[model samples]
Target: MDMQMARIGLFFDGQAELQRWSHQENIFERFIIEVLEHARVPYQMIDDISKFNTVDLLIVGLASENHLIKEALLEYAASGGIVISYGGLELLSQELGCKILPPLEAGYLVLPAEFGQEDPLRYLKANPWQYIDSESVKQTGELSGDDQKSAALLQIPVGKGYVDRWAINIPETIVGLQQGTSPVTEDGIPAPDGTANLDEGILKADDGFELDWEKDRKTTETGMPYFFTPYADLWREVLLGHLTRRALDKGLTLPVLEYWPAGVQHMAMISFDSDMNINEAAEATLQVLKQEDVQTTWCIIAPGFSKEIYEKAKVDGHELALHYNALEAEDGVWSEEAFLEQLEWLKGAADETNFTSNKNHYTRFEGWGELFQWCEKNGIQADQTRGPSKKGNVGFLFGTCQPYFPISLADEQNRFYDVMEIGFLTQDMNHPSLADTTIIQPFLEKAKRVDGVAHFLFHQHHIYHLPKVKEALIEVVRKARAAGFTFWTSKQINDWERARRTLTVSANGRLEVLGAAELPDVKVWIPLADADAEERGLTYKYGLPGKTQVLQVQLNKVEL
Candidate 1:
């Protein structure tokens, strides 16, 4: 065993998966991979039980009733290997001394307050849970509904090791929470909160706003008191933190790649929608960005400002991205062909052949996956349409500020869309009653807490027309700068994320930067079991005594 590192293995049972679910994409498998990938935790996918000895922790996806698989897991646990079970734990219920109750419908996972809950209670969205009851097993969390509360998270002692279990289908629930449980049909989800009245048609992201405004929205110190808890991202952290605790308890080492480059705590991106195509407004917005020494993403509409203005923007290193209009007022059509034509128009208007990102005008999203499909087909690297259009719907209505590839629920393969969706926190920031700092502070703070990008959207017209909007923009830029965040263009952010995904850390502590990728600013921090271990070959770059040691390796040096 490498004393300096602990390898993680995710166990997939193809045979059992085939028997239980007809879906081609093993969502459990994909979910585990996505979680690990996002956390920058190095892991290997292993199906064979013969290689169980290679991993310090084995995550079993959909632990169906297969005798051989159950036996292997039992053997591994007996030998002191940590295991995390996603669902289908009935096979080991008796052996682990737990009673599996009848399943309950969708509810919330009431986690401990230590896991970033502002109040005494924080609930993560959950799919149906087959409640587990055990007096002996340690219960870490519970599934909560109006009339029922059941044991949801359990740490069962199995010989020398432990089986950490989530008594639900975590993957399905996560997918549902992030992508939405239902499709966006013509009959839109009516907002009872009176956020968006989809009278004409349900075409925008706000139509699919899933969170219950009253229950989910948390009160902040500032304006409106509607800083929404990012439930999906928080749930992801809970899983990661659980795994990390177990690994550390077992005296194992795990490396985490920080989200931002150059060791910054978090990131912020300021985006502008060129709605009216007003030349003066555009110029004023550009000047604000320049004065702040920031490069932003300009989502250009058709008949955008003059070619000279775009040229100046391009020259100033701002990202020129398309803002697709699908409203009748703009003579827009909501079709694939229409989307393509507008994209080409923007490319010509900006005089740029390669535009990396886009956001739909009015956030006109019609279907569950069609827009993403169009983005994939058109080589659009990122989309920012999944966010709030109404004031009441602000702050993580999509459940995240992080950029993630949308999963294709329609596809048989359940493929991930190549295009990244970086949902904005809020738009305009010009509400009459609200102060700019009120929204600015909490949104940025929330993004920082989740290690995500604080994306602020301000229309070019609003920046010039609304006094408060300009004030908000300046405040956001200044505060984000003071907090050590580098404002990046959407293209830059997309490029950085894509580049970081290529990096891999091996079990032997050899960090591999594949594809000759050179990311000098990126930081890789490895938590060591013993900071003073003489056998540790890697040089300790950062940490206090008796704390986790970080190895700061330059990616450029390791690039192949």
Candidate 2:
């Protein structure tokens, strides 16, 4: 907190046409007020332009026709003050100068958007018109209807100050206030109505927009608004940063985590199969991901994937995997007959490189090394080839859903290779009964409690046909982020190893890791190389996995 916090004057001419665009909850005003508070940027609502002299930030809420207020805001900008105007700010942006040219149209944020003019009630929550590349919008990640768009230019630097114009009001500040986050998110629910399906949009030409509420899935419950207060820790830290920057001496000591030597304490891996559409999946799949988004490594890819498909995807910042389904031949790559045959086939399939890591199709046999003894030796860092999961939940005992390597040598019983095993947390997500929101929540809770990483195994076919699942996966990442899950790609891991410190501490010393590696003290529970599972099989018959690690850390823990 600064003694000289920002004195933001929010100009609200009672007749501003912006008022006519009142959000479901008067979100614009709520957002304006909240940003000032959360950012610890103190502000006031002004009804008259005369209230300008003492303010550091002037927010003018203009009616599309409020020419007087618009000009005044320009004057404020020229006078070297922050001038942010919404609602009719388009005219000012073009005549006054800004970056985001007004959009040709706009629409309200809806939960499950309406689709099919024929069957109006087909509640699909997205529109086909949102230009994937909207030059003006700044915030990234997921976009929803509530996030207003401006038909006007979104830019800064009016005269001496900066100007921001919006066609629709975005109450991110208010939503953050209620949800305790500056970003739009519904953390826990995988598909909990307005939460999981979060988005925000703005007003545009109006001609290109269409929203038939009677057919749409709907917005949040009137009382339980889609947006709520965000967390306080972020605001506190930011407030302190600004206060310190202003040279405002407040003796405000804030807790901070600095210079993370080993980042990403946790990570996730996705499994692919022969069905991956390398050529066409980029735009539909990889491109749809949030920008600078969380990264993931693909496993079990065919050798054919590397040449053109993988290269193209790599260009778009996507990772590749061996996608080894050598098990397609019932005998698996281990048997002398299977291994020799599979190895020869794979080696000649393509020249880029052998599969980095291979997975048993259906997990019938995950020992991919049979085909190529150089799993870790080659470059394969992780293996996600476990359960697509049968009726009950499943996982490697002693192994957490989070990434961890088998620290022991592979033996006859449980001879898992030397890479990290990302056990299954959820699968068949597109399957009917599995899509229930109720089911996903408890699963997530159990994951948090039992070191589950919300392991999701998505196939391209699943994403192509079931867009909702694609949406769910997004929610999964969001929830994972909220629950302190740090995303890590092998590259990030390499980054850590590259900068790692050679500890000179005593042999018994240890350190904790968080995010990618939990901190305070990082203690990874390495599974025993082998667990004599013949004498220790799961109760009943591969019974339901409880809050316990399903497989012992040892190789023998996995009953062959």
Candidate 3:
């Protein structure tokens, strides 16, 4: 028998229960459903008020409150059922002792001038409205929520159940509220006395209400989607990158699982594009990488090496990935077959088995998709040879500066991969010949366009040629950090996505691949922060443990 876990009972408040919910009119409700689905908590909809008596989880739409449901809800909570209410349901939060993200709206927000008579709010005295927020809605603008500083709580075991409050502003608002983008506060009011921060000095108005600077100085409010996108510090604070914290709050269920931090557990992959380069010349740079305790997936050409060279690279902690020449393809060989050979050759030296991770070999574009498949076949965990940033026309496949799905290879059912892309934002910023920070801004800007890992790409050879590139790269990292994005390794990112899933052989006997490949016995040596994919060893075999068949392999230096 499979383990029976938490199954929540849902109860609608009086109002929503009676209306016979015509369909999720609010996309916000649909999004909320997605988050709950992502969380993998078992729940069922309860429309018939008569069957609500044993509801394990009660969801009361704000407008759908009723006397009978309210009484049942009180009894359910007192009897120990979980009650989750939202929107107008916030009354439950106050009554049950909690709060939701405040109902806040920015003065800078561009609301529509036209309202339809058929809209939900049009049907009632209290009007209902909807708006879509940018992925970075929190940054660049002010958090113009109502001054409701009320805290939302999840009270466990009151009577036979519990209660949790939610403030819905479409699904992304929750993300926005959490990401420091625009949030929907309770009461939808801005601070009457002006935006107050006890620390930073904010400009004020005479009557004490915050002045609408965005309104007065607005010439082009249309370009920036989020209301705050124009504010410099706010933009930096919210838009620069990843949602490391707010994402965690919607919650990570295993209360005590140790965080295997990408900051410490990830290895940044660095490779130089051109080189009839020498190992000795590369020594100083490699030494610094080692001295700094960083590991590298050092992309090298086969032309310039002797035994001592490989020994030296090994000594300095370098894992070699092949950077081949396109013109030197074997006569009559299809590019795919040629790339396969190259992967084999690289594997011989570096031995990354069954991991689909590779970069370009001489910036070749032919059959790159095949190359990706080839890498996948050979155990390359991920393939990163999207294109040469400075040189090729990175055919808009994977995506801009974010770890995403190969446009053609996206897992359609997995919405996350529906047009995904990620970048190891590698480029020599300090080169006098390089366009400098102005151009750099776009790449960083590219990262803020969506939510995916920004794995920066930089060359150790450039650092060897000019130390300033390293400094400039560090500055880029700082700016990205200030923008709230987390620097991560390819593997670390893979792990983060992997960790977010829960594999359940559902009541219907379905195997769910939560977020990634469900590789249980697969031993992958995850590179440490200071160490990356320098050469590692691998071994594979089959076995039976606890009456289950499994394949086992060990990655020499990587640890999950």
Please report, in order, the local distance difference test score of every candidate based on alpha carbons: 0.72, 0.38, 0.37
**Candidate 2's TM-score:** 0.37
> Model 1 over residues 44-145: C-alpha lDDT tens digits?
888788888799999887556778878889889889998887655668877776665657655566566544444322333433233244465777666666
Worst 10 residues of 2 by lDDT: 114-123
Model 2, 304-384: lDDT tens digits are 444555555556554555554444343334344553344345555443454444444544432223322344655555555
Residue pairs clashing, model 1: 203-365
Model 3: per-residue lDDT, tens digit, 1-560?
A: 12222344444333452343344232123233434433334456665666655544455433344566556667766765555543345434345533344244432221112110111110001111121222311211112233432222223335644554323232333322211221112112232233212112211111111223233211112221111121211211121111111212222111111122222222233444425455554666656655555555555554534456556766765555555434434232335676667656655654344332455543334421344455545555554555323311111112233333331111221122221122344356556544243334444443443333345556656766676876765566556655655544444444444443332212223212222233343111111112223433421111100111122222222222
RMSD of each candidate relative to the true structure: 4.3, 25.6, 17.3
Relative to the true structure, candidate 3 reaches a TM of: 0.40
Models ranked on lDDT: 1, 2, 3
Per-prediction TM-score to the true structure, in the order listed = 0.87, 0.37, 0.40
Model 1 scores a TM of: 0.87
Give the range of the ten consecutive residues with the poorest summed lDDT in model 3.
Answer: 116-125
Which residue ranges in model 2 land beyond 4 Å of their true spot? 1-266, 274-278, 290-292, 300-306, 328-351, 354-356, 366-379, 394-399, 407-417, 433-453, 490-560
